[model samples]
Target: MADSGSEEIAVIGNTDLTPSESENNLKNTMVEKGTNLLKRMEINVAEAEKRTGKNAVNMQETYTVYLIETRPVDAASEGTNPVPDSLWRRYSEFELLRNYLLVAYPFVVVPPLPEKRAEFVWHKLTADNMDPDFVERRRVGLENFLLRVASHQVLSNDKIFYSFLTEENGWKETVFETGFQAKADSRLKALNATFRVKNPDKRFAEMKHYGDELQSVISQLLRVRARAADRLYGVYKVHGNYGRVFSEWSAIEKEMGDGLQSAGHHMDAYAASVDDILEEEEHYADQLKEYLFYADAVRAVCRKHELTQFELEMAAQDLTSKKQQREELATGTVRTFSLKGMTSKLFGQETPEQREAKLKMLETQIEEGEELVKERNTECDEYVKSAWVDIERFKEQKDHDLREALISYAIMQISMCKKGIQVWNNAKECFSKM
Candidate 1:
């Protein structure tokens, strides 16, 4: 979907997502300051190990943990450098960190983690978690996820991330103390209670729509790729059968027997090459899957923006209603029919002192409501600016990453075709000699 020249899917900031001049200037200043404050850290997930583990109940279980190595890139003053820090973390722990990030930084499009279990895999690819190839691919993906977070101007500076990288012991307890999961649950409940936004920004609406479209397109692509790979595998296996038939026929020949056997060998080699080629293709497919999962993160940001806008509108509406009530009280007239006015008419008009007291209470509430409105407005504005800045950065990264992935995939396909052609050409020469 992210074609090189097509701005439809790749370009997120050119439209209403573009910030105003003041916001743009503010974003630039904030980014510059953030860059200076955040240190560059090298993070890697170089290996994985499957280990037998004991559960809380003393039950035995098996699990895999990844080795994470991190070091401050700029720590060296001139020559001497500190030793790199290393830790082993379960995949579940990575989930914990990512969940915290999503909750803590709702405005940011947090990077998605690789799938814990494989799906839509072909025959050659196993769904088993402990498969060496699958584990290696996942390790690479986890590394990429860390690199993405480590490179972020905002995410890089998070103390929790540092703790996740270096603090092997009591990390979960530290994360629990932050109460992030409780906050996320509370937010989810609020969202579930009210799914409507009175006023939605057009930019975020477009972004949410883009997220859906991107997810859909990428998912369909992966499905097609899997199906194509299955077919390709079968084709290569059929050629292997053809090679066997050729060798068997050569056994009954005389002068051309040698040529036929050699041609059969060439076919066998060509057929065997598909295994490695398809294995390499899995790497490219993983890249596509990365963007496929990223679509969800984009929607999460949009949903957070909508929540902010909804709160702002609710606050402003409450302020307006309070002001209107104050005006009606002072004017001795009801702008709209109310139960309180009917009650006053049936019982008796309140004394001037009581009326004045009620007016003062209304005035106090009006002031507080006005302040709340202003605060919510400011919150909404800041969220929009910060979210847009990150979105702009994300769009650039997405474009570059997808472009490189597609280019590499194309090169791989071209090389596969050339190798196939060479194999057949060699077979053809053997036949010519015969």
Candidate 2:
């Protein structure tokens, strides 16, 4: 967060000027700017009032104010990291705050009154001005704003936030009344100051540095696990040639298992860190579910492509029986094993030519199974992509519906506000005429 220099209190609509026209001229200019800003805000408020068929004065209240300041710290030194120039330059805290207010105000202001037409202007005004926790309340509002932005995974992507302006039902009233608007405004001001001092490039660089390190650890672990699985698969496929494949399989398995275990441990720790920051328990659970889905998909591929337990067991039995038969022949005891019995052989060693042929046949079967697994994996990837697309589309539709509702509500509010303002204005006119 960044500071907007020092804070100075200016009268809401001061008109008096002393001897210095220069000072007065500047003051007048600022006043006009402030007035215009307020008028624009009032217009929005009026629109909300009209749409809701509620009087604006009935909802008006004094809001607490707070200020947040951001200053830069040396990146090379302790307790500081640099941010990217692009982010600092492009991101606007003010705009974000404004958006928050636009969404949250309506819900916070004006409780239901029994008589919809009843005038509660004085009561509302008095309550707003008299609240003792105004300043503290404002601080809480700022905290909420920060929490929402920092914790929002979708918005953190940056692309998503930039691409769409999400709308909500009766957003204007929800934002202002809830004090989300004020809080967001303050936080944005603070963020602006921080961006100016720290810059976005430095911040992004730090994030990338950490992200890469974490990803590397995860990658290493996955590779190790995959290697181990491959070694086990090779051993099962070797049939009677266990001695030939044993040494090779053992070495590969050792290397892969070590790496995989280490990487998995690191990933688990990082995930825990993420969980700590997320307040909503369900959010973390949802993320876990998604990760599990991906993991299961990967396992499904392996299962489809690799040799099954039944195939491995049969191969092993056939190899043992063939070795026994060869021993008997060497001892001049010819024991005939029928083709039917050979067909049930586990290691697939029957006749000399049949053994060779079976090996080739098994190889072809394995390849075909692997191809099917690959196709399934591709389908799974496509499904994941389609799911995300659907989610984005749903969000867009939700936003549209909310906007329509808000506009309708705002129109009603504005009509009511205009009527109130008109009555007040007319009273002033009548007073002047008198």
Candidate 3:
């Protein structure tokens, strides 16, 4: 399939399955990926700043700005045929956009930004926590937030949303100001008034069913990818250990090969033996180091697998949250607020009829969210399958090299032992004649 779901066969170190596990899983994912429109307003965020920058003589800041790319796309184009326009924005900018939507369309549940986290010791500049990879993943989550909002009916049509999507000016502060206004316009008022979800229970149930399917696929893929990543990490460590060991062993073997070579007959035999062992070991040592170098390639794939799972997991969580939000609107009690930020329950709740209307709008969002999930799942499947091919090829080559190296070393040892026995017998014969 050209555009397929992300999948990989991890049976070697993972769970046992039939021999044709890859084929079977692929077949199953193919079934899950029902025919759905796979394109719309394309949005992507990349080129995240993963390093710290100097501000004043003593101050430093993490430059977490990312390039937000967007363009109109169709099912045929699918975000690639035509290039996208890119602009740089900070995580704060994305947060601003989301908050604005939350206030502007209180009736419409806005897609959320990822949880904003700060670390005192391991901030954005740190390798383990806020490295380039972590920044990149956060950027992807923010992009998904934008894409979800853009697909909504009322949210997509908002002028503020349009500016956020395409505007390149100092729109952030202005958007922040506008959003805090909370001033309702005629159109927003009309949306709130006319919105109604008839038979809310039936539609919520329908969306819940499809939403569950998308969640299952995403979660399963994450679990499988996680297993694969840990395995790849183990592989990297193995190669590195072998690389270090053989690398040191090769040096010692070379020292013996050079120093053990003196000019007498018995010494010549010893020299020859040393040379045989050195040649065998050095060749395989270089092989080990070469594979250790290749381990980088494996590590990169593992990172990509991690990223795929993360992006899909974010998408899945968004859908599930959206479902819950819809359910709350459909049947749950109204959100109540208190004066002076104090706890005081004194208000009339949303009517049963009122909740149903909001549920209708929410149902539309959930349905759209499900479609996006499927499209994402297909792309993820494609990535997982491709990564699997690279991983399997690496394993095969490693296995072959290991087997060949062991055989060559064994033969060298046997030859050296046989020659040593002959030399010992000849020396005894000489001593007896004397």
Candidate 4:
């Protein structure tokens, strides 16, 4: 049971899951999925073009697509090791991957992907406006995203992962599911397996499950927060370009300054206000990351407890076997055993006295082993209890903090939006007067 003071800290159905560490080697056992992906595969955005349907009359009906080139660097199979192969994928395809990662690994902060703009008018206008420079920029962003996913611990090892990097016939034309429905079942299965304790036990199962849930929720929240930061950067970057475009137009800043001196400053101020909101959002994201850290701590402790129990069980079995062997030796049952059992005697016969001495020593060793296991188990249990106390306290504080932060962020974003509308209105008024 967790500490009473922090009893309110519950993951599922108000059950308090404590944060503790038992297996020091548990972390070492974690396979870095992302690293393995990077070592085995490389991704590059190759030839990009607009794909059209059977009808050639309407060229504008075509949508932009890119050839995703996958290079297998070091595969063991004869046919697997090869030159780079490629496949055509639309922006929507990449979008699916982003959504899949966000939905699946709720703990991971999926990188910001390029925004979609499939509008007819926008596409028409940007036909010539969308230069190779801009296309390359977006491609780089997409490539960076794949690299990030490749390095991610959970995302890298997913079954659907191969479909992403491989140009295998079926997957080459694979259509991705959209929204939360995309990869939901597979993600849940992965999450269940990912959170499972190696040494299974009932008491620790719920704790591990709840811990995983908390980690996932917290991670998703952080991903949202980071996305806000990404949005801010996007806004900030465009705002700079806006200023540049304004500078190159109609004596720009000076002409605009003639009408309202504060107009330019007001736009900057509004951006600043939005940026502040984004900053706050990013901070909340960071705070959620801390919660994930605590959740992981709980899992480590739970695993340690499980491993200790396993050790205890094995030791008990060993003790039982040793005692049985001692009884058999004392009763001369060894002499009546089969050929294999007496194979050692063929090499060197053991006298009755020698056999008795060996049995006594074996019994002493098993007794000592049992005692050691018992002591270790007691120590592990104590640690588990202690960890639960800390987790409960931590849950009370972090959960409260997270709630407060969410409220604060909502208020800030709302306030900023209102301020932005006012500033834009002011700018419009100032410009009309000019």
lDDT of each: 0.80, 0.32, 0.49, 0.55
Better of 3 and 4 by TM-score: 4
Candidate 4 local lDDT, residue 202: 66
| Worst-scoring 10-residue span by lDDT in model 2 | 41-50
Clashing pairs in 4: 20-301, 23-304, 34-151
- Cα deviation at 146, candidate 2, in Å, is 34
Which residue ranges in model 3 land beyond 4 Å of their true spot?
1-41, 50-60, 72-84, 107-109, 115-129, 177-434
Error of 2 at 63 (Å): 36
Write model 2 residue lDDT over 122-205, tens digit each, in one string.
Answer: 121122422332223223333333333322222212221221112223433433443445544553454344222121223223
lDDT of 1 by residue, 401-432 (tens): 99999999999989988988898899999899
CA shift at 281, candidate 2, in angstroms?
29
Q: Which one wins on lDDT?
A: 1
Off by over 4 Å in 1: 1-39, 56-58, 74-83
Cα lDDT of model 4 by residue, 1-434, tens digit: 11222111111111111222112212222234224455567777776776666444654455677778887655534456666778777776777666554443332333446434311111112434145544654565567567655654434555455576664455423434323453455544544553323456665678778889987887676656556566666775565545444435535455555545445555555555544454344444444554565576567546545544555566667777777677766775663466635765677667878887998898898789779677656655654554455445445655676788778778877876777678778878867876
Residue 46, model 1, lDDT: 74
Per-residue lDDT value at 281 in model 2: 21
Candidates sorted by TM-score, best first: 1, 4, 3, 2
Backbone-clash count (model 3): 9
The ten-residue window of minimal lDDT in model 3 covers 7-16
